[model samples]
Target: MKDVYGEAIFDFYKGDHSVVLTTHNTYGEPEEMPVEVFFRDHQDFTELENLAITSCEGKILDVGAGAGAHALFMQAFEMDVTALENSPGCIETLKHSGMEKMVNQDFYAYESKYDTLLFMMNGLGIAGKLASLPFFFSHCKKLLNSGGQIILDSSDISYLYEEGVAKPNHYFGEIQYQYEYKGKKGEWFDWLYVDSKSLVQETKELDLHTEILMTDEYDQYLARVTGF
Candidate 1:
């Protein structure tokens, strides 16, 4: 996989704070993401993010911990936090940010037990497709300690389709994306945006219970999964 996303992050942390990362989505025009967003302080976090952070307990694994922002916040309260990132460049950035503990490994490939798995910024999209949720939850079950929870945020994205229009045969939330930075384009990857209802159903089948913790008008929501 192209490491363009991590390269941008490393550059921004190294004083190129003006860098902007662009993403080309399968269903929409390319979107620009500010590198600074990865470095947000606790006060700048959205209500959903703050809730996810506070809901965390015990040994916490910040999955896909891009720049270590969430992990750093948990560390402030002396929480046992470890950042798990795959990108070497982002790992370098995390080290420079003074993050105490981090693992440079892919989520599924890394084996560990955690009381809380934090997946902010739609981080659960790593599941790629709706069909992959079972495998995703099974892995979550393996990695989670007894009484552990998975705290995550995602968007419904159903509104992206017209009311009476014919939707695609595949799930609308299964989007393909590519990242671009400084004229470098990354490999395309699949990302998911499961609606709350479907998410609940999927987890239920795996004997996991999903709670809709909070939601906003934009169809974005925070959720917690337990009963693993």
Candidate 2:
């Protein structure tokens, strides 16, 4: 609840080049990744992110638009884009970085409809758990206009069990994460990383059509889902 991650992004934006993210996950030891807020441009984007951006059309909503990176990319093309983020500090950074439209609100409670809902950086993890997929789809249905599409990315995460390790009792993709910056630790939160096969099956039950847009060697993939 302290928005430690957002604070780090804001600090990096304010010229603190030493900011880094310390992430603790259920499946692994703590890892440190440098936070390069000011330097995140189109060149730093992955293939999946590029595919999603080029495929976007009409009005767009970039969910969890941290540092406004994806939204900024779309804005460069003069696309109608809104950067939606819940972090106040990140929102400040987004505004300072010249994001024309920024919203400080949760994606689930957002009511506007858009031609494209863009979720990058494993954005679908916001669904939290496999059991929440139905509700996630239902909410997305309400936020999409006619012929709209949801472009998002996530990893299979099955590689964690390749060493003959026992999987968690719940779904494999259901993960817990916490963030640490400096000497402070944030609260733990649930995140999901659904595989492509399971995503297709779940979408079918929701009456939505899913397409595997791209898959990399690392089991991370981008998917497009269209409402009925």
Candidate 3:
């Protein structure tokens, strides 16, 4: 976690969620890892950052609103916004930030509908597992307002590969990663990188249409919510 805002700014200092948390290395060695933390300050973000997301104004739900940056952006646009995060510590921070609009509820249990579902920063992994797409859609659908939209930002590692050049027969994810934290090189980072068309194809099965909302070379999609 970065030390800017929201991730670590809890009002009442409390204990952590009791999950058997541990960080691992590419070698699969275990190292103790601390919880991620963040903090929010209106002064940290520039004016351009505010303008980027404000263009979409409606009842917005900012999922995985790390540090409340996007939440602040939506609030500036005068839109009704609700920020939900799974971390209890992150929630406590937002609660005391004096922001009444933020909520700590999990999306699985959230009952309200939203016109806009804004997700960024690995939020596409809300399903947690690849096969959980249907499960994710089932729970997340309950929160969509009529004619709603899902704006998800994720990276397409396929873009990282040059065209026509065959990728390694082995999974690129198998090339383990090294983490240098707590004065050690550790932690294997293996997570799926959804291809641009893969998510589009998958979403279509659920009767939704996805398009490249914005992409320079990196592929991001504005997954439009349609039938079902």
Q: Give the TM-score of candidate 1.
A: 0.96
Local accuracy of candidate 1 as per-residue lDDT tens digits, 53-131: 8899999999999999999889888999999999999999999999998999999999999999999899889999999
The TM-scores, one per candidate, come to 0.96, 0.96, 0.65
lDDT of 2 by residue, 168-189 (tens): 9999999999999988888999
Per-residue CA lDDT of model 3 for 69-103, tens digit only, reads: 67865676577888887666567766655455876
Q: Can you tell me which runs of candidate 1 are displaced by over 4 Å? A: 163-166
Q: How well does candidate 1 score on lDDT at residue 127? A: 99
Q: Considering lDDT, which of the candidate structures 2 and 3 is the better prediction for this target?
A: 2
lDDT for predicted candidate 3 compared with the true structure: 0.57
Question: Against the correct fold, how does model 3 do in TM-score?
Answer: 0.65
